[model samples]
Target: MPQSLFSRMVLILLGGLILVQSISVVFHLRERDRLLFRSNSMESAQRIADTLRLLNSLPPADRHKFVAALNSPTLRISLVTPPSSQPRQSPDGANQAASFGMMLRDLLGENPPIAVTVSEMEWPARQHEVNAPYRAESIHPRQKTAFTVETHLQDGTTVSLDALPTGQAFPLPPRLLLNLLILLAAVIVLSLLAVRLATRPLNTLASAAEKLGNDINSPPLLETGPTEVRRAAHAFNTMQSRLASYIQERTRILAAMSHDLKTPITRLRLRAELLEDDELRVKFAKDLEEMESMVAATLDFMRGVDNPEPLQPMDIMALLESLQADAAEIGHEVRLQGIAAQPYPCKPTALKRCLSNLIDNAIKYGKSATVIVNDDDKQLQIHILDHGQGIPEAELERVFEPFYRLENSRSRDTGGTGLGLGIARNIAQMHGGELVLKNKAGGGLEVILTLPKPITSGSMATKTGAASNIQAKKPRM
Candidate 1:
């Protein structure tokens, strides 16, 4: 489901590790409980055996004293007449007493007569009867398991043992939780490092691709990393080389054509100069000049889009205001509404040229233009708004095509070689940006020139590091 390869890999690895750890923890805890239960059961039986041996060795007169000394909260020991060998089952059906009876017979040798019975601590039927020679106390009422053991000795004496030893409850292992946390931390750190390493080449490809859009001559990809990544890089590098070659070849052809056409254009201008008729001669010169200007503009646009100037930090606010001031001098109404928060790395000359063209269009078609600069986390936006009739919706996209414009703005009267908006759009796209036009809400046209932020080595830049004249938003009237 994840779009990123790195995220997918991390999810698979972390999910499997957590599941395996969960199963192992569950299994180990259960095994630990079982072992604890078995060991506690063995110890309870041994206690009864050890006390029986000590009691049998003492005389009848000292038996009660020894029994009293051996009695405990869990294990109640005393002497009494041997209970019948008849079976008395417990309420919970726990056969611990039966199991221990067999153990006692083996531990005390075959000659000893031993019998055992287990019952719930709250045995409703009856309690064990102790002989007058016995000195014993009742088992703790809280005790859950009430077991009684009877045995006959060689001297014809009998003794009884009541044990209610509970198995140890499962312990909460803070140590285990601590261990899991440490392991999880180590895994996360390792996963992050591994993901970064795996995704590094893809990141390189992405950066190279982005730069390729701005500069067709972006440097070749590194072609390093895993086998798959290396193959992808190789293909990418090959593609970049082919594209740059193709664009370069096309540019070369256009330049040569423009060069060849210049000679004829100059010859015609010279011939027009020698003509005698004033009206005819002047028209010939005008036609020749217009032809030369169109050729020059076309070639200039080709060069601007494919071969952009080098990037440098520029005060875009000052640049816009300068344009506004220049237009005002020519009696064209241009207003600088807002300014950028910082200077950014850009081809200032190309951008200025692009802005000039857009502002010219806005003023010529829309009567007046206002330039507003706004920037956010990712890109810079410059809006050129005009107060005249907006372009028709159907022709908004067509207006950007070279030599193609709206019927209103494309007339010879407008005096463009039909390359102004096309050239401006190309310049913007060459900087990894877009120039989009839309009709404004209040009855005018708005052209938005969106420029991408400069990509830095470690990360994409969000703020300008160098100081410029404009640090805060201020409008210069």
Candidate 2:
């Protein structure tokens, strides 16, 4: 199916807006997560620091009890005392004490001036790096001094022992997802509304354009909408008005010219009647007759060009039969072919003039004329066939130009002014129809005139009148 410009525009706009909003939502979530993570990390670090200070003031036995009571895999406590006189030794000897002293010395070098050691500890569920140490100070508030502990996670985050429990480090905010969803919905709805509002005027402009070709006299379009839309509509309306006025002016000029030429042509014919020589008088009269015919055909052609008659229903078969009988009466062989069954909506006078010209041309040039009326549910086609010297492919289109006769040889005997086909085409177009000329399969030329079907009650009435007239005239009777 074909898509309208307005719908396509809205679709493109909405799609782009959705894409941009989606990217924004992603970035917003990332930024929010970063902020929440930092906040949680700081709070955990502060709690851990406070816990370590409390642990350092307790005696060794009480400190062990406190550590056991706190029992968290993420936290550990240790006590270290310096040797009194000789080097202290256990079953493992100097190596163990030397290792422990070196680790504690490294911890004291870290910031906050507290001794702490970290060792990799492996367990069944997870692995951790834990460290803790104590120091004695004279100015300390407690009996001895203070100890500090630190833990590190695999993800590159470090927590001080004085920090709070990592178990409650950060919890996801409950309303965050709901708020994001609301924002997303609002954005989509607002975008769609904006698109609709912006494209409404464009739709109106398209509709107006479609109608313009068929009805040039339609009222000016409503120039409302965005600034650009209003400007475009105003320009279009101005162009339509100018085109209509130009056509009207041209028609008036042609009518005036035709009226003015008739007086001189008539006077010349009257003057030729008094000529003394018989041969000369006959030739002059013949010339005058030819000139008069050309003048009349030219006037008809010009009138059709500008003032198109209104549409009415016409009997397709009847119109053809009338032309056929008229040709037969003139001693020309003419036949009616196909169905004369249906009536179509068209301009009656314009359509009749168009078909009459076609038949006249056929009879004049081909010496015989045949008309066929073909009808379908949707439209009607009228074909006028003539057995004559068909037009050359090159001259077919040129034949429809005003005053453009075929070649000198063909025009000599026929006395054609070359306006027949041009006038036929003009009449056909006035009725929203077209005239097409083509070479027949066997010989001669076929002229096809196509007209639209009627759709209203008033059209049906007009069609009935034309149909009755066609049926009343019987060739046999």
Candidate 3:
């Protein structure tokens, strides 16, 4: 299934938006987590430090009251002083000062009045060692109080502080992920709605274009959408109105000219009947014939000015075969080659006339014609070959102008009204096809007709038939 431009545009816009939003959400969550963890950790560490400072300010007799007030199953605190003469090694056979120095630096000032140390242990062991190895000594300047505080909290956690605080493990909240999922779903739904809203006007414009081609008098499209879309719709409506007016003016002018010519042509035909000299009469008749041909061609051209032929599925091969057969019956050496067995959707009658004109011209000048059809998936091409005197490169395009014959002489004996090629080109263009004339390699003219492949039901049916035929004709034992 082929998608229209509007549909493709909508899908692309929504897809790009979704991708950007997803990336933004991920980055946002990561940043939020970083900020949240940093704030939480800072707050927890500050609360612990403040409590220790308050405990230190108390009088010696009121110290027990301070500790009792601070007592909680979720938190514990213990104090340590410097070792006297002999220092007891920590249970892990490591110097406590070295192990706790880094944590002390982090919690307190990097250089404190009293040096501090900190360590970590499991809840049970941390409680058991709270009061062991109590010692007193002076390690700080001017008899400052130096203390070691150990705290055991619920959930099998302990914090041993000589100076600084150790960081805790923190995990992202599950609710954050759930919220992100909800945001993503909402963004997808909203994006789809936005795409639909943006493309609605484009869809209306497409339908209006089809209707306008079918009938110029069709109502203008409703313009409702964003600013850009409304402006575009307005411009399209204005262009259509101008085109209709131009076509009407041209039609009126052609009608008046055609009406005026009829009387003069009729009088001339009547006057020719009474001529005495047969030679003179024949010349007059020839002149009348040329005039009649010109008038008919002009009328056909004028009629096609506004009203183009309707499109339909046409079997190009069958059309070409019929043309070849007709030309052959008239003793013209015409051949058909490389014809596609499939039917293409086009204006059959208009295409038939266009081909006939080319073939007729070939037979007239070269006395032979060849018609070939070739189809690739992209396009359908029809080539008409002739052995006629090829046109000069400069004059190739000029030949398609009405009444612009290559031959300088205006004599009817040359057998051309100079309108055949012009009419053929007009018919081709009406069907969204092009007629191109080029010099053949072997000194003849080649006319190429190129048209877009059609995507209609009738054309599809024809393609199906062609496929079936090819399958049946496949080589077998």
Candidate 4:
């Protein structure tokens, strides 16, 4: 039921330890009961047989005095007249009596007639007197075992002994539970340490995997610890190497192809310029220009995949202001809102290109673009919204595919290569961020760019020590 491996392992180990402890306690109690009962029965039977033999050897007048000598705290000896009939006993009491009587007969032979009866009795609570007839050590606390043994001697004198001995039930060792608790606590501590050590490698591997997504050039995992964990780390490092090599090779090939195609495109453009019919010349120039644009866009897309830009902390507001000024110069309206609390870690050029493409799309399809920034310790979000007809629901995700576009948006009149959204998304992913599109309620499209902040050693300290501005900035109209 536990979600974490550490918690699950501790629960299983603790459960098994408790179960084994319970079984051991039960078995110990049973064994203690058997040993105590045997010793107590044997001692009681031997004392009674010896008392009867001593009375028979002495004269009747002196027998009573000697009986007082045989008395003890556990056993009381006295003289009694023989009973007319045997006393009735419950089945369990009768069985105990029979067993005790047989033990007496085996010790004393058949000469003396002996009768034994066992009955359960409770000790009075008020017997706390220090000088009572029986010592506190000789009496049981709650239920006590009461037994009466009678023997008829050779001269018809009857001797009776009543025993209310202690140790009828084995007293529990006072430190049993305390010792078990201590053992359990120690074992639990050891189990936690072992489980944490065992799961540490898994945590490292997961962190390495996440880091790998952010930067293909990130360092490989260290191959240490157990054999299985070492093997997994080695495999992950190998896979990362292969992926990086493949991307580099693909980028080199695309770069060569783009270079090879540019020469032909230049020649075609020059030849078209020398044509006699102006209309035919314009059409040929347009076709050649479109082809050249497609080839350049494809190369850009490929380069975005394997961009080698390093991350650095940069002012987000300054970048947005630069973009706003550029759009203003081009006669396209762009508004900026909100403030970043701190410099965000990012590949500056790649992130700028990503935002530029998104803002351009908004300006092209929608009338104008408004960029809103929301920043925190965990992540930075920039939302670019527009004021034109929004994309259809079915084509929202499909528009991100390379060279794919809506019927109205990707026409030749619009002068687009249809790879802008794909290139933007690729750049966002390379920075360990995401770009998402959604239709706004008031009519237009909204592009959300989410960039996660990298966690560094001093980040937490800085966050705790620095004062943050929570008030939002108003958008420029």
Candidate 5:
């Protein structure tokens, strides 16, 4: 999954999503804490300012009695004897304390001089050195502190407002964090699905191209997906159509020409029969017969190469033995060795015809051939070893060209149209395999027909092209 383009894209997108989500979570929590804490501070400032206003409204004698009335669990207003020079800041060292002080001053008005000091009860003025080590961000919304306000009244009595839990602090809500996590997961899953959808067409197109190489008749790619994908598919289909048409047309022309030539050669043979000169008549008839046979063989070769056979499952062992028996019957020395151990899907007739051609070449030249099949998971290697005087290394590939016999090495009678190897190679390639030629270690030629196993669901093309090794003298034909 990770190797696929779609999977890689999904992983990349998921990484970015995770990074963005992490950043969002951090920012959201920090912002939530800030907003909540600021709100708590403003509330604290309001309560303090209201207490001071009530004290100012009360007469000096009534201030002490009203002080107890203003006292609550969150706030305490007491009459201190005298004002102090310094007051403690809140234990929570956040700037909210200063902000609260400014807000309080704004509400109280400038006409009366009001001094506000919010100090941490946990770390009091004289105990700053001792409790400073414990100063940390409070998890709670309520600030834990002592708010002591000391200012002289007109009668010299100091009124103080002390609030407990004076610090302002807030943490992100658990519910909000949970919702963010759920949303992140949902988006990530959806992103993966979208990436898969986008890349699916590319995989299909690639698979179709591979199939097309093995079988030009492979089904056309489905011309549907995004607009860009559809356009590419349409072009691919058009190319396939042109290629298929071109191959069929060429095969048809070869067949037509062969048929037309044979008719003329047949008429010539009849005319030769009516000749009075026996020797000349015999020569003309012989030439005409050769011409007719050559045309027929050439037509057969073309048909074999361009066969439109579909792949079918067949046992390699059975095919090899069958070919061996056929060759032996014809006085050809063909030996069989090692089984394929399993059946593989292929164009049975094409593969059989290909093997027959190679074996025939081996018997014709080397006088004997050895067929050996060896296979692994990915490919089947069928080696045909011949003991003939192998062609020179430079001319090995040239021998497989149609009508390209080495007259010096190959007798005209035996090298039938010189299209056997060429046709065999075409058949092998149609099955997605290849033909390879190599000189045997000792003497003669070794032909390796490397056929691919089914890639997954169906037969693959075989090697694009073998001959055997034997120590026997050439056939006395």
Candidate 6:
């Protein structure tokens, strides 16, 4: 249930590896147990057969003396009276006894009837209870397994053999567990590295897409890596190239149309001047001016669609001061406050134009403009406030559309072509920033231009400067 592809892949690979290792270990243990059982059975049969041969070769009284030498921890040999009936055994015990009997007969070379029975024996039990020669006290109490073999010798004497398998195949040693852990750790580390490598291309593609949104002219993705990655990068680069071409072509066409329309407007203005009636001439000139203005504004909007200006670091406070000075020269009231701690990366010409439009709108509508700058490592925010009746909530966003003005009178004196906010927002988005408008609490409009700081911006403390309200006053005549 990992959210990331890397974590999911690692989980699946590790889970599969752990599962396979478990199965492999199980099969390995089972096979080892099987081989060990065969080896132990053969060894036990040979030992019992050799003991019988020795007993047959020796005198009857001496056979008892050899019994002590034949006895061992895993195997014990003794003489006993023949049982009156066959021994009872469980299903699994019966299978084991039958297989062992076959092996014993093969070793002995005689087809004598061998009564073999496997039984579960608890620790500290009396050896006489199951008729085993002796208990295997060296084995752990948990094992609790014993086998009894009774067969007749050449002299009609019955010999009893007890065997306790070593059970070496089941228990896992500490060293082996440590080795398995080490191997698992190594495999997990390698899997993480491989998954990261495989998913790295996706990260690159996403970054490229974000950069593309900010600047169409941003560098293309490098067509390197696996075949699929290369193909994707190539496609993205192709799309970017096509989009850039389309924007350039549209700008060119708009510029040409603006030039062509201005020629007829100029001719018409000259013809209007020659009219005999002054009132009619004034009306014609005004109409011609409005048409020329609309054409110029349309072209400007088209140009703003894509500005190829390269980004560079600029002092934002200096730009604000210059704008304030320009407004003062025009007899417009402008106030400035706050300081930028560091230079911000932006298109200097485009940014200056964006700020100029907002400040001009504030002065024209609100009679005065107050610019407050809030700068930090993360982003630079410039808030332009005005002291006019705030716009209605419904018309706030509608005013951003090109040529859509709130002044239904359509008088140039009341509101210039409504493309200022649109062009300004376009420039902000080009720099990967945002511009938003809000109604101030104190009966005014507030426009906030938020520009994000680059990752490498320096860490510096920004201090608020004393507010300087500049007003242009006409000199005394």
lDDT of each: 0.74, 0.63, 0.63, 0.78, 0.72, 0.78
Please give me the total number of clashing residue pairs in predicted model 1: 0
- Encode model 6's per-residue lDDT on 1-477: one tens digit a residue: 999887888889889988998999899877776667777677767777787788889888888888886776666778867557755678868887888888878888889878888887553434344345554563344455677888777888888888776444446679888988998889888888988999899888888898787687889999999999999999999999999899889989988988898898999999999999999999999788778767766665666667787666677887788788888987998999898777776777778778888898898889999999999768999999999887888988887888778764333567477787887888888888988999999898999999998776553223223222222221110
List where candidate 6 sits over 4 angstroms from the true fold.
1-8, 32-119, 125-143, 148-162, 167-175, 270-289, 365-367, 386-401, 404-413, 438-446, 456-477
- What does candidate 4's lDDT look like per residue over 1-477, in tens digits? 899887898889878877887899799877776567667788778877777778878999998788776665557788877566766789867877888888889888875677788866564322555245644455554665767887778998777787764444657777987887898889788878888898899889888888677677888998988999999999999999999999889888988988999898999999999999999999999898788778878877877787887766666777777778778987999999999877766666767777778888888878799999998878889999998888889988998898886777546577777788888888888878898999998888999999887776134233311122212221110
What CA root-mean-square deviation does each model show from the true structure? 7.6, 12.2, 12.1, 6.7, 8.7, 6.7
Q: Candidate 1: minimum summed lDDT over ten consecutive residues — where?
A: 468-477
Model 2 lDDT-worst window of ten: 137-146
TM-score to true structure, per model:
0.71, 0.65, 0.60, 0.78, 0.64, 0.74
Model 2: CA > 4 A from native: 1-12, 35-242, 276-278, 333-342, 366-378, 408-412, 440-443, 452-463, 466-477
Give the per-residue lDDT digits (tens) of candidate 2, residues 339-423.
9455566666656677777888887778888888787765678888889888888988999987887774358466777777887
Report model 2's TM-score to 2 decimal places.
0.65
Flag regions of model 4 displaced more than 4 Å: 25-119, 122-126, 130-143, 146-162, 167-176, 409-413, 457-477
lDDT of 6: 0.78
**lDDT of model 3 at residue 191?**
69
Q: How well does candidate 6 score on lDDT at residue 69?
A: 68
Clashing pairs in model 6, backbone N/Cα/C closer than 3 A: none
| Pairwise lDDT winner, candidates 1 and 5 | 1
Q: Report the number of clashing residue pairs per model.
A: 0, 10, 7, 0, 31, 0
Q: Write the per-residue lDDT of candidate 1 for residues 314-407, one digit (tens) a residue.
A: 7677777777777888899988866676676677667777888889888887889988889766788999999888888888888787777555
Q: After superposition, which runs of candidate 5 have C-alpha atoms over 4 Å from their true positions?
A: 1-8, 39-181, 225-227, 265-306, 364-367, 375-379, 388-418, 438-445, 453-477
* Ranked candidates (lDDT, high to low): 6, 4, 1, 5, 2, 3
- Tens-place lDDT digits, model 3, residues 1-477: 227665676577667877897898799877775555444445435545666556556655675676666643223454433343433445532333443433434675444333333234222222323344322231112221122445432222333333222234456678867987887778668767876777778778887886565456567766766789889989999989998898878878877887788789789988998899889989998887777667766666555445555656666777776677777776878888895745777656656766777888887777798888888766788888888778888988998887788764323367777777887787666655678999988898999988766556333544333322211110000
Residue 97 lDDT in candidate 3:
40
